[model samples]
Target: MHELWFGAFLTPTAENAHTLMRQAALAEDVGLDIIGVQDHPYQPSFLDTWTLLSVLAARTQHIRFFPDVASVPLRPPAVLARAAASLDILSGGRVELGVGSGAFWDGVAAMGGPRRTPAQAVAALAEGIEVMRALWTPGGPVAFDGEHYRLDGAAPGPFPPHRIGVWVGAYKRRMLELTGRTADGWVPSSAYAAPEELAAMSAVVDRAAADAGRDPALIRRVYNVSGRFSRLAGPGFLDGPPSLWADQLAELVHLYGMSVFVMAPTEERDLKIFAEEVAPEVRAALGREQRQAAEPGTSPSATLDESSRPRLPKRDLAELSPAQRERGMHLVRVHDGLREELAEIRKGLEQVAAGRGEVAALRSLINRLTMRQNYWTLGSFCASYCRVVTTHHTIEDERMFPALRAAQASLAPVIDRLEEEHEVIAGLLTGLDAALVAMVEDPDGIDGVRDALDALAGALLSHLEYEEQELVEPLARLDLDV
Candidate 1:
């Protein structure tokens, strides 16, 4: 599983310098992993990104820093390398390098930087990467000749204290391919690469990595995201409560394998909410997901023979209206999500003994930032997920099932069976909640949690499949407002 991270994206504006600095410190204090200050040197309102970052790094104790994609066009590659390495050393190796093939050509040209065509920009960035790497390496001297850049016997100086990750902010196909082939990580902003756009962009990176004989997994995926807080859910992404934010971010990690989330918060509350609430929830959710990933396709042991499950009379789906078919499939889709959650519970049970993993060992030694994440994951997280399942069951029992039963008399046996299973599932959820509390109280109480989760997984997954098989057609035909 990819190691997880949460960061804040602070805009380095001259007017809000102190405010942004406080946000950075607060991010560290509240257990965020990194702080990224954006680079827009040509802009009159902005303070230099590197200058602000250096000050913030000196003020804070643990949190790391990065130029949220440096404007490599203006800064020569060799000089930029030395400056980055110097900061990494001074900051005790808490620096990463985020590079971009220059955007805003007019602004770049005004800043006395070369204005290149797209192909030229790509070629220049590639060569710039080579120049930076050579400077970072502990070689005697560096000599290179290229169309865009030429380095002649440039003595490699003060090496970085740690291996800094070169994360490229990429959007275009060629740029994405460059990220896969050369960069240590890929950094994409939600503003440019929206959630719907990630999979296809990531595919480009992965394909390029494969063709270049590199392990795609080795290249980290970092996402710069922004969202708002609303009590009621909205049509757009991340436009809901902190819980919604966590769930959406967790889903990104699960589906697309992007592990690092650098939030471009619009306000200080946004930063606090993301750091205090959202990040921990994402970690906890991800722990369960990673457990499932460690052992793929794992589910609870079956308690019922699925062959004996009842099936409702079927209608030819081809004959149904498109809207009707979609309405019927809605129930099936909801059940699919439930089944996926159940599968995580079962897989997580197997690794509960090693739940804390290596982190638990160090947890006693230091209250490290990363340690706190493990604490939340192994302790407080399970109850939230359990509560979710319980709520789902409650909703169905209180609303959907009753509506279905009233809508169709023929669905009585199936509904009766389903209600019986819901009761069983509800009890299992209670047991899981109890197990979570027990595990927290006594960290070694793996057996109780395992047994509870195992029982729940078996009953829950079986029930969902049975419900889908028995009800999809009925819902299509019944056309009730369930």
Candidate 2:
């Protein structure tokens, strides 16, 4: 399976231009792989998707940008191909194109673009892809005549810095078939298609790819998802805590071969949590699964050691006392606060990286703070965050674990493992602190600091996910005072 990728899907509204910019910057700083903006040219309040993406590309570095799914009716294939290539070149090859057969026919006609039936739209999109690819091909004076798109002696030049992938936003059978046949990737939203429906849709795409003599794996799967961050587990999908989100997304990768998850979060806190807590946990869990699958003669069941794994309490929420449920909610809230702090630390590291010129410079003319000042600020922030995490872990070790063990003898082994993991994380945090100090002494040590942070983040996030999965139900069932 491909390495899992995570991104943010931000709304492109003219009314919140500053907010959008800040979110894009934060998405990059938090180590997200991509940033996708929705395309709806007819919406008066929304910014033009391409224009907004161009601005974002100039403002941020290292994060890929895309129009979540451009409306092909309004965006002619010829012009769209050039725009994508130009932006990809300008952004140093950090661009992917997500195009869709046109929707909202009335809006397309209002914009003086073609309005076509569903069949016509799909046909037109296939031709559009051919036209774009021809234009992108090197040493090409393309000559093509199609019912939807025609080109004669159109000299193809100004190729992209990289092979820009054309991801199709497809759902229906015809569109999915076109995606499998012509597109580089498949883009779908969970809101429009439920989890249960995904397997059927993927089967359609897979069959089409096979029919087209294409390796299905070569076509990427990118999902646009939306969910809530809550204390207690909810009935619906992704309506719970960070661990729930991680588990669900990881399952998608393992089962359906969906490798990229782009969260559409309206709240900034959700974006932070998704990037810092959820994304890391998903990566770690998937890594373990992948490694286990690679080992010869090892049964998947044996890999997890189910005998020692913590089980959810038998009682449901309705069976738990009100006070116990409240305590459980409190624990989740505490974790949420820690997640936010972790996100801040990650963002601080990104700022430090930017200040040291480890990342490409922003295309801005405004004056900014000195590199030294930025470094010092980041060091201070890291120190504070480290202290908070350490203190939180100490409290859990001294009070919560002991109380839980006393209340439920069966939880002893789980508590012991949690405590042991705490010690390991503490050591990692100390290593991070040392690295930060070294960076302070020598500015060039930013790379060392980043390496240390990556290690710490990986270990800490995995620990957090495991702790939550094992403790949330038990905490809700027992009324132990911390």
Candidate 3:
């Protein structure tokens, strides 16, 4: 597995499954290390998880895919052993499975299956890991006479080429012990586990791994940081300005040893806003600071954007007198659409989070809200960028270009670059839609969605400002022709 693996957990609905695969591919395209799917039993709406992963493995060439955390009790060790082995083989050795004591109570109970106490669940998980490892090892037939499950002469053939990392998900002392003793890595749910709790869990796992004669350095302590991306309000709000957000993220970096940050933006529109408005600043600022350690003796000034870096055209659109009226109208329409869509996403998220309805219903609502927000945020900037670029194309082709060419041929090179901007922006729109579809069906897809947004925003913002600058001079000259 990568040094720090990060993935989104997704339910197994058909729409969500397909969405998750596409999102997984998109994440890989954007440099995210891993993709994760969620497993649940007896939910008529939920798809089969291992099956979904098999499909994802077929579709994605390089992205690692896994169950963020598989609830161990639902699948017996022998059965899962084969499934995981096959998936690893099919994915060309990119499958990672994280097993945990079952977390969803109602799903377990609804199947008329017995739900183990937390202690019992933890014990079962440990025994389960032993069975899986033995079955995955080709040298011997595996047998486990354990309390929760018993396997006699079980064998899963042809082991993974490398050591398959098994992650034990836990928070309690005993669970941490199980993680240290048998598993390759440890991931504790951040739902209610504080930093202090994480520190304690890390200590327990380290001690146990060492006691078991396993390399402590092989174990990874993964923590989840959940946050929202609603319209940042007030002066002191942490979400605003990339510099400020980077400063805040520094706390997570320094304290958690967090190499992977899984961001769950609160609303769909906010995701785009974050990608466009917030992500770039933070990435540039914080990413530089983190790399400073590796590149010792590097001055702070060296890290800053140098003049050699292409700057956005500093000229104002107001100087383009001939096209000012048309450009202003186009911008107003684009801005209005952005505001309306943003409001809708915000309102929907706030309602779902408020818990006004039944608890179960609220869960569904919240999931939808999160998914919707992820999609909206993933797509909004793309949509806005598309609108502006398409409008510019129409204006240029129909009116401005004709007028400019008749007046002076000197502006052709600038026009050519502006045309290139159109192609760049179109490519971004295409990529953004693929990313947005992934997150819309599965909230967990937001990890990929965020990265896409970050890349798209950087490109879109640069293109928008560049095109405007490239055209401003030509248009100013057009005022005389008009």
Candidate 4:
């Protein structure tokens, strides 16, 4: 199976031009994998998706770009293929194609694009795919004649640096079959097709692939999701905490084969929370599940025995003020980010072992966790701190643990155990950095890196859970903000 990908679905609003640029940059800064901009050329208030994407490509070094779903009627298939290939070559192969048959008929009419019925639109989409692939291929002049899209002796050149996935946005049976038979990926929006609705849709796609003698696993699944992040649980998808978002997203992956989750952000904060908090939690949970499925009785990830860990008395959150409860929830959010960091570390190690890793991934992990303190993953409140380890002691022992100890003297043992775990995790991080450098020098030393990763994962995941378990309620109960 392909690795899970997390990204943001940005709408290119004319007024939010600057915000759009900053958010694109932020996605890369926060270690997100890709960015998708909705295509709505008819909307006067929105910037052209391609123009926005080109500017973003120049602004950012990493992170990918794609039109969420281009209107096939508006963008001629041959021209669209050239544009995608040109950008992919220019951006070092960081582009993908998302095409839909047609939407907003009046807008298409205004733009001088052909208006077609649903059947004709699907037919056009199929022909458009043919025209695009023909143009993308390195061959002589291509000729095609279909019901809608037609190409007359079109020359193909300026090949993409890498293979660009042709992702189709579809919901109906005909479109789904086309996706299963011909498309490289499937793109669906949660707003239109909710998570529960996708299983049946995917079944159609799979059956079509089987009937067409194509492997269904070859077709990548992408979802354009949207929702809010609240401290309290609500009755819907992505309606609660970062953990809730992770659980729901992970479920989407396991059940419906959604490898790519490009969320439409409700707030600017949603972008950061999605990348730093939601993505990693989902990756970690999915990884844990895979490991468990592979080995039933032996699971190294479950290193800590929760039954033996120190626990403190809980309090009723209903009694606390909203602000007080929010402070505790804030800690949970920060802890979620740290958990994400560990997940990145584990993934990086696995990639290196498999000979598919990038040095950037390893460097990012080592640089952030060992060399310097990134305020977001660790804690923004400890901005003055030196590094993760330095901040851990200074922020936790000097400030956090002391406050909790002073507030509830009965919880001394739990606080002490957490502090010891912090020290343990710090040592494991130091070992991880050394292992990374050693692996760089000797390829065969990857086992050492993997060993280091297993130890760190065991220690860190257990520590974070223990810290949250003992501290979350106490933080809410106490008047102090730690």
The residue ranges of model 4 lying beyond 4 angstroms of the native Cα positions read 295-482
115-190, model 4: which lDDT tens digit per residue?
A: 8998899888999998888887767988897877777898886565445789999899999999998998999999
Model 2, residue 156: displacement in angstroms?
0.8
Q: How far is candidate 2 from the true structure (C-alpha RMSD, Å)?
A: 22.0
The residue pairs that clash in candidate 2, if any, are none
In model 3, where is the ten-residue run with the lowest total lDDT?
A: 298-307
Q: In angstroms, how far off is 204's CA in candidate 3?
A: 2.7
Candidates 2 and 4 compared by lDDT, better number: 2
Clash numbers, per candidate: 0, 0, 7, 0
In model 2, which runs have C-alpha deviations exceeding 4 angstroms? 296-482
lDDT of 1 at 475: 73
Which sequence of candidate numbers ranks them by lDDT, best first? 2, 1, 4, 3
lDDT of 1 at 243: 95
Q: Model 1, residue 295: displacement in angstroms?
A: 4.5
Supply the TM-score for candidate 1.
Answer: 0.62
